[model samples]
Every structure is written in C-alpha cells, then in structure tokens.
Target: MRRNDCFFVSTNIFSTGFCSLRKIVRWMLVASMLTSMPVLAGKTLDGIKARGVISCGVSTGLAGFSAMDSKGEWHGLDVDICKALAAATLGDARKVKWVPLGSQQRFPALQSGEIDVLSHNTTWTLSRDASFGIHFTSIVYHDGQGFMVAKKTGISAVHQLSHADICVQSGTTSEKTLNDYFRAQKMKFRPVVFENFEASLKAFFSGRCQAYTTDASSLAAILQRETRNPGDYLVLAEVISKEPMSPAVRRGDDEWFAIVKWVVNALIVAEEEQLTQANLDTQKEHGNAVVQGLLGNADDIGKLLGLDRAWAYRAIQAVGNYGDIFERNLGSGSPLKLSRGANRLWTHGGLIYAPPIR
Candidate 1:
C-alpha cells in the first residue's frame, strides 16, 4: 500500500490531513515510538531543543543568587534552576547558556526571545505581571527590602539615617522603593544612584553614600563578597517591603511555563522525599506512593507533561534536591551562608511547598 494509504486506512493521521505521504508516515512512526513526546505548541521549548541549549537569564553577579567563578563557571540558586530545567528537558544539566542580565535588562531579554527563562533575582509585583507580557512561574526566594550601613557609622535603625546619603542601583524596584520609603517616613535623604549593581556596591565602599539600600538578601551578599571588610557592615533588621523573587517566562506559553514550574516542584518534592542524587537509584523503589510518582517508578508522572517517565528523575539526579541546591548555593556550603528562614520546607515550618505529582 502507498504510505498515504497506510495512514488513511489505519485512521492514525490527524484530522487535518497532510499533503505529503512521507510526512504522514514519519509522524505515525514518531507517534508509535515516543508516546509521550511533548507537543511543542509554544515555540520556546522547541527552540531550546533545536538549539541544543536553554538560554537562562541571571544576575551578572549576585553571590548566592547568580554569580560566575574565576574559571567562568556559573553557580547559585538561579543557576541550579536553569540546570534543572535543562536536565529534565534535554537530559543534560550542562546544556544551558548563561546570560548574565542586569535588573532592567532581564525582562526585555526574555521578551525579545534572547533568553528562554529569566531566573534572576527579580521581584514579582502586580504591576510587573499586568504590564509586562511575562508570567512569573514560582517564587523561589522570599525576600524583603532593607538597609545596610558600615558598623562604625552608629546607624542601628531605619530612622537612624534620616539625613543619610543612600546608594541604590538604578532601574530596579529598589530605587523606587527607597524613594517611597523615606518620603513616607517624612525623612530627608540624598539619593545616589548607579546604572549597575557593581557600581553601586563600589560607590558604597568608597563612601559615596553613607548607606546602601536594597533587598536584605542582596545586602547579605555584599557583606559576604563585595566588601573589603565583611565585619564592618551591618544589615538592618527592618524589612521595608515584601519582595518575592521568582523565575519568569514570557506569557502565552503554557507548555513552557508548566515545564519550568514542574521542574521547580520536582526539586522540592525530591527534597521532601529525602531523595538525593546519591540515593536516587535505590529510592526509585521507595514504598511511598508520592516518591514513586516523583521518581517515575509508578504512574510515570512525566506522561501528563508529554515528557519521558524519567524526566523528573534526571532533574533530581542532576541537581540533587531543592535543599541540596539551596545549601550548596546560599547556605552554609557557600559564601552567603543565608539561613533558609522563609525558604525552608513546609514540614519544617517554612513556606516551601509543592503539590502532589499524581
């Protein structure tokens, strides 16, 4: 029988009949072999697969969130998310291109298709969601705006520096937040702004400003790595605004958004099940139903997302677990040493939680 005749007789061809016999046969063959091959209706995932690398946007250098080593290796919480997505989709953690983006450039890069995912330290606000043609997938870090000052300045509280000169990075929520904060408090201050984060840190170090104001996590990072004297600076305890940092993707791509969102959930689920890269091989046979679903041992959770049964398994093995990613990048294992205060798992009295994979 002719190839077109074969597809027609079998009723396997899509309702929208194809013109070419060769195309019809190839589609049937692919369908038979890979039952769960993802439908790439959103061109973003297909583009990443075609290019053999997922372009991930990240901060130029934000210590535990996103930074580069002397050997040009990317490391941080944001970097791990990028790698995890690569591992889940392409089965290779290293199949990722890191695009270091500034605060203002990150969204534009994602919108322009320059990056597949923006995992930088970006706050999710109502205005950003409504204005930008972007969708925030999940909040990876719970943060807040705060102030940092040199210890010898005798500044202990937000109101202490009423007439202080503050260094802030331009084109960031921090810049505007800084302005609104002092104005609301009925205080006066000089606003010293720089285009880039490094320049703001440089100015802060040189005494161009008496204080540096930004997210508390960023303040901790500066104290850890950017300062000549780590002990000389103190991060104030007052959190001025809520900053929920999340990974964002261009809106209108439901498939790509699900892939990124589930990759993050896979990490958290792996951590909850105590499934580490070292123990994943054995844990696939774990008696717990949720663990079985997550490890692709039973029900094959990836089928729902049109991925291979082992997609989540590969991601967990590549990046260990969510806790592993956190500790390695931002906690005691790294320079930042940030305590997992609100970022801890729900079982441990923190907010990190994931839905069931079944």
Candidate 2:
C-alpha cells in the first residue's frame, strides 16, 4: 500500500506528460491503427503467434483481483482472461506478459500497444466507449460505487456523515461519482484525492480522511485483506454508480475484437454448459450439439480467429469456466466471500449473458 505502487506513473511516457489520460489514449489510438492492417492485417493472430505472448495491463495490487503471488505468478479473475487469450493465440497459457498499470495508465497502455488488452477493473462509460476509440468486451464484473468507513466512527450510513473527509483514487470514475453523489445530496465533505489509490486508502485508514470511496467489491476485498477489525468497517448500502468492468482492445479491428470477445464469451458459455477445467475433458467429448460446436467439432469460428477449433477448449482449460473463476477468486473458494448477485448468468437470473456461439 504505497503511492507509486498504486497508480502514479511518469508523465514523460505519456501524451502531454501529466494530468491527462484521455489525451494519451487518443494519441495512441491513432498510432495503433496506423500499421495495424499491415502487421496485423492478416496477422492479428500471426502477430500474437510470432510475438509468443499477449501483454495485458492490470491494476497494481488488489487482492484476489489482479495481484502477484510471492513467486510472481499472476492469478485472479482478470489475470486468467489474459492467460486464456494467450492460450487461444499461442496454445500455451503461460505465454503472457503482465503489464502492471494504474487506473489512469491502463487505457493509454492499450491504445499504445504496450499491452494487447486492458484488464484493469475499469468501468465502461459512455465517453470511454465513444471518445477512447476502444471497444469494451464483456462485463467481467458488475459493481457499484460505495463508501467505506470505520465502524468505530459509529457512522452506519452515508447520510449520517456530514462534513466528513473522504479519500478517493484520482483518475477513476470515483472522483466524479463521489462529487455528484455528495453534492446532489447537499452534504458537506472534504475530498482528499491522491494520485495513487494506496496513498488515499492509507491516508483514509490512518485518519487522514474519514472514509474511502471506491467500488463496493474493491472496498470489500481491501477490508478482507487489510483490516484487522474487518468488521470495523462498513460499506454504505448506497449504490451510486453502475460499474460494468471489462477488458478493452483497440478499435478498427473487427476480427481482433471478435477473437477477444469470443474468448471471453467462451468462459461464460462454458460455465453455462458445466464445462469447468476439471470436467472439460469429460464433457467436451459429449455428443450434445452445443458442446460439440463450442469445443470446435462443429464450426469454423476458430479459423476466423486464427485459432484451432479447440481454442475455446484451450481457454476453458487455462482459466476454467466463469463460475470456477468467480468461486475461486471472489466467491466461495476465495477470501472475499462475495455472492454472485448480479454477476450470475441471465439464465440464473443475473444480467451477464453471452451471445450464442453458433
């Protein structure tokens, strides 16, 4: 939990140096498309094949989300997606390079081709969808903005805190959302915004601010990992903003989008079919029409993506199914212990639904 370790990056490496993520994303968007058709014209798949790995940008350190183990192996829901892309492209899941990026630097990294995809827990916004010239694929997680405050403060609801200081990570949707929520409610509060999330969180926890504002899932993870009085903190029930987090790829490349999209969709679809990593081998050979098609025995979808028919199979093998990832990282298997809630598939009464594979 440090400043530079949070989201701070040198401005010299980005467009306009400081205070602008959109500017950097814009400039890189133009560059990524310049020779995209040549190097990746027919080579999107070949480029990744030749490069040997897929480079993806992720958050600095959010436990059970996108963090490194002692051996430097990356494992998490988002991390698995990147590995799956590598498996689909290179036929080897470990053939991936993890580019640790802070919240603001993530999109720019994707546009500049520093990474093939942005896997940070970034919310898909309208402006980001249109102006950034990038496509967000799949809602990997459904979340909402919330506030975290120490229980010792005896403040049970956000409405009870008047004139309380709040800590927030800069360059996140939290900034505008926090301001709008507080101002619209006519509350008085001081904002202690920092360039890095750790700085803000540390400050807030250390009494620099009365509360920390971020996505509810993140606040829960932070509490689960860092708080001694984990029960001492309360996440206010107010859901201020809807955060549909997903991975993003550069625009103007429809095929590339399809490949990434399908790779993601495969995970969700596989979960629906009960095709976990443990059971994929058994069920992949099942005679069900959907199973055969998804496993590449029935169609040419893999050929278009520059992958073998079993690309989806390889993806599920690398990362398991969507439910496996959820249970392992954010659900029953992990420390977070979060309920599926809105992340469940449509058939299960959740909002996340994938397109038909056929």
Candidate 3:
C-alpha cells in the first residue's frame, strides 16, 4: 500500500481489507463537519464593528422619524433607534455614520449590505418581509397614511375633498394608499407627483395642489417646517393604512439581525419595566430580577448583542426608552405633539410589544 500525506494507512483488521479505517475516519470527519456547520449566513456584526462605525440608514428628511437639525446634526425617533444599536454594538451610542436614504432605495441598500440597519420609516408588510430577504424588528411606532389640506378648502373629512389637487411622493406606500382610497371612494383628484417630500410640500404650498398626503407623522413635520402657515393645514380625520414602522436588516443574517432588532426592543422593554437613565445606575446595584436582566445589570447581556454589558444602560442614558424618545421628539414636549394612541403599550391597547430579555 502507498502511504503519503494525502492518504492514511490503517493496520487493523478493517484496514487490511478493502474497508480501510482511514476511509472510515475520513467519512466520520466529513459527516461531523457537515452536520455542525453554521446554517445562518454572514459575519455582518464583525464587519460593522471592525469598521468602527455602525452605518445606519434613515429617511432623507422626516421630522420625528429622521431629519437633519439646523447644525446638520441628525435627531429623531428613527435616529435614536440607530444610536441604540451603536450603543448595543460598540458601547458608544454616537458611533454611527448616518446614511440618508430615500424610500425606494432603502431596501436595496439593506440587501446589498451597504447599511447595517435601516431606521427609515418603513412599514412591516408581509410581502416586504417575504420578498426583500429582510426581517422587521419591534414595531417602533404605529403610523397611518393620511392627508393634510389647507383649511380654506372647507374640506373637513378626507372624503369631502372632491376633485382636490393632491401632492404625493412617488414610489411610496403613500402613493398606493392615495390611489386605493380614491378608487374605493369613487372619487377623482389630480395627484401632483414629486420625487421627494420637499417638492411635494412646495407644490402643495403654491396651490399647485390643494392637499398634501403622506404618513401622519410626516404631515406634522411638513406642516411645522415647510408650509407658510402651519396652522392653516389640518390632517384629515381618516387613517387609510396600517403602518407598523420598524427597523429592518438583510435576511440570513440572524445573529446580526438579532442584535439590531433587540437593541430597539431593549429600549421598549426597558421603558415598560420602568428602567430609566436617571435611576439606571442605581438600579444596577439592586433592582427587580427582570429589570436587572434586561438592563444588563446581572449579566453580560449587552455582550450577547455585540456590545458591552452596560451597552443598553448607556442607550437608556443617552436617549431613553421608546416612550421617552416619542415624548421628547414628537410628543407633547415637542412641536409635533402627536398623540400616543396606536403607539401605546399593549396594556393600553396598542402594539408596542417587546420580547423578554431572558
């Protein structure tokens, strides 16, 4: 028999025959590896950490959700979600490179791995989930498609605006919602299409369109900032779509997706459990066991999400829980003053639920 590095020689009774122990050993090793190999694909987290910044995708400019401030500093509900991920992954909430993306481009950017997580105001629909190879995290905010019209139009309800000229963004859920509503209601209107919200606002403001339609949150932002008189426009009292705004990541990246998903969930969980920035430091010393586990006090739970144990603690310290972000950025404290109707906790008959950290 020939012996070399590529082949092994066995001297046992099986080795003497055609059935060699070396071949059996080879089969065993191959079988073992085949069964034990990792099923979930990609090294997404390590790639982001090595780059030293969490590349987050956000809306081009939606106020409350994501928008640039006067100094070009980004702040909003969606931005806070991304910052939470940075804290969970890198221990620094500010360790993020914000990538402003439009509606149509967000999915492609995520699928191509151009961004780690998308904090854009995206809806979690079944088709998007199944087709985009992306997964939705916690429902960060509950939203609905609606219309905002000038008060002078004398249109109190959404249906009352007959032959209304509407400003709408192209290639968005807003477009679909607008079409469906008009079709169902047997109504006719001129849809002034624009590629972005800024242009839509311009058209609507100039009377090229009598009304501007978008997500209710976006309408609030556009009203306060873009229009001549914020008070002159009113959001019609009809929600046309069920929008569960969430963060999404590429498919087959379970570990990485889990990290991103839970970072946002941890905020909601933290808030529901009454963990806050002011008392988080003291609570770590001695708190409820559930709160301790969630806040990463009793365990290195943060490390499990590609962050230090105190990563979640730092996030809570920086921005706060889901409610806190909403309250400060878009709630009564801010100019938006959006009500927490569908965004409240399930106990309060809303959909803001989070998984247990344990």
Candidate 4:
C-alpha cells in the first residue's frame, strides 16, 4: 500500500472497530520508544561549546547576591549559579565571562545575545516572565521589599514614614512597590530616584531621603558593608511585597532552558542528599541510589539534559550544593550573616525544594 493509505488505515482502525490487541501493543511500544529519545542540544549550547565559555550577566554590585571582593573576584549567591552552569556545560567552572550590568541593562543584554544566561539578582514577576523574551529557570532566592533608615531618625515603623522622601533605584520593582505601598496607605512621599545602585545608596546615606528601600537581604548587606557603623541603621519589620529572585535565559531554546533549570535542581538535590564538595568523590563511589544517580554513577540523567553523565557531578564539585552556596555567600559563614529563614530546604520547614533526580 501507499504510505498515505497506510497512515489513513492505521488512524481509522480504532474508530472502525478493526484494531487488534497486538497492534495496540505495538503502538504503545512505539510511543514509549519515542518518549525515551534523547534531547538534542540547542544553538546556545553549541555556541558556548564553540567559544569555550559561557557569557553570564550579573548585577553590577549587590552584596550577598553578586559583588566583587577586595581581590576583584566575584563571589555571591548569583555568581555561584553562573559558575555551576559553566561547570555543567563546559566541564570547568572558570570558563565563564562575567558581564556586570545595571538594573536597566540586564534584560536588554540578555535579549541581544550578549550573554547566554542572566544570573543577576532579579525578581521574577508575572509581567517580566510573560512579556520579556526570556524564561526564568527557577527561584533561587525568596526575598521581600523593606525599608532602611538611620537610627537617629527615630522612625521605627513603615507607618512612621508618612510624606517622607524615599531613596530607591530607578527602573526596579522597588520603585513601583514604594509607590503602591504609600498610595494604598493613603500617604504621600517624595521619591529620590537614581539610575545607579551605588548612587541610590549614597543618597540615602547622605540623608537625601528619609528611608532607603530595597530587598530586605540587600538592605542588610548595605547596612553591614556600606555603613561605617552598622548599628546606626535599622531594617524595618514590615515586608511589603513578595520578591522571588530567579535566574533567567533568553527564550526560543527549550534544551538550553531545561539544562539551566535542572542544573539548579541538581544543586538543591545535592543538598537534600547531603552531598558536599568535600565528600562528593567518596559519595560517588558508595553513596545511596539517589546520590549515585545525582553523581552520575547509577543513571545517565545528564544525557536527558543533552550533557555528559558527569554534568551534575562537576557542578557539585565546583560550587558545592545549594545550602553550601547560601551559607558561604549569605548565611552565617559570610559577612552578610543573613539567616536562612525561607531559603532552607522544605524538610526543614522552608520553601527550598527540588524534584527527584531520577
């Protein structure tokens, strides 16, 4: 029979009551085979491999999220994400070109292919996720908007700042949230907006504005690192809005998107498996089934992500797990000294959770 005749006959067999059990089983087997096929690597992965580096966009300087130290080395929670991606894709965590971008430049740089992925401390919102030509991989940090004021101001609460001048960075969600909050409270305030993150902080510290508003974690960092005396500033208890910070990549590449998404998931899974950089090699040899799968010992999970079997193993080896990243960058081990309040694993009564590696 012709190919078209065969296709029509096979499709109509079920409706015509001519289908047999053997044919049904054959179709099911074919479906299973098709579903088990490996995913093809996309152009983004191909370009990264050709160039031997992954271009990553990060915040200009935000302590505990993305900042440069005295040695000019970038170290933060977001920087670690970029390193993990580099390790998974290029087999070397150092094979990354870091592009520091301001608030307004981050999205345009990612959209224009100047960067393969954006690991900046960006909040995931409905409008940005749907409207931008980018896909948010996952929420790596859960944050909220807050206010900071000098202790001498004698302002203790959000309600105390009625008709006050608030310092905020322009082209950010914080600016919008500040307006929304005050308008809802039936109050008025003068906005001291600056395009640069540093300028905003400078203006606030110089007493140009009554309060400085941003993510609570960022406020803590600023208070610790920027202020000469940290005890003089206060982070208010009022959290105005939910800010789920996530890394994003340009759209139109499902394979690249899946690779980025699972690389993050692998970090979380490593944390759940109690896998750390120090003991990763030992666990690879004699760990449990889940640990073995994560370390590329039992299953070829990396193949499904268009990578080698040791993709996740290399990522964990380079940056450790999610918990390790958090502790060293934002938690007690770092200068920020921020608590792992909501960024802890779900089993510990927080929101951090990942799917099974298998």
Tell me the TM-score of each prediction against the true structure. 0.86, 0.87, 0.85, 0.87
Question: Per-residue lDDT of 1-358 in model 2, one digit per residue for the tens?
Answer: 4766544444345535544777778889987777454334344555667788888888887776798989998878889888889888788999988999987788777776677778888798889989997889878999999889887888878887789988988999999999988889999898888996667778988987888988999988989887778877888888788999888888766777788889999999988888878877778677488888998877767887667898998988988888888899899998999999999988999987899888
lDDT (CA) for every model shown?
Answer: 0.87, 0.83, 0.82, 0.91
| Cα RMSD, model 4 | 13.8
lDDT per residue as tens, model 3, 130-248: 99878987688899998898888888898787798888998788888888889999999988889956677778887788888888888887778776677888888888898888889
Best by lDDT: 4
Off by over 4 Å in 4: 1-41
Per-residue CA lDDT of model 1 for 1-358, tens digit only, reads 6988988876755544554676889999997654323222487788788999999999988888889999999999999999999999999999999999987889888876778999999999999988898889888888999999888898999999898999988888988888898899999999998886778888888888889998998888878777777888889999899899899998777989999999999999888989998999888885488888887888877977767899999999898899999999989898889999989999999989988778
lDDT ranking, high to low: 4, 1, 2, 3
Off by over 4 Å in 2: 1-43
Query: What TM-score would candidate 2 get against the native?
Result: 0.87
Sort the predicted structures by TM-score, highest score first: 4, 2, 1, 3
Each candidate: how many clashes? 0, 1, 0, 0
Angstrom error at residue 282, model 1: 1.0
Off by over 4 Å in 3: 1-42, 299-308
The worst-scoring run of ten residues by lDDT in candidate 1 lies at 32-41
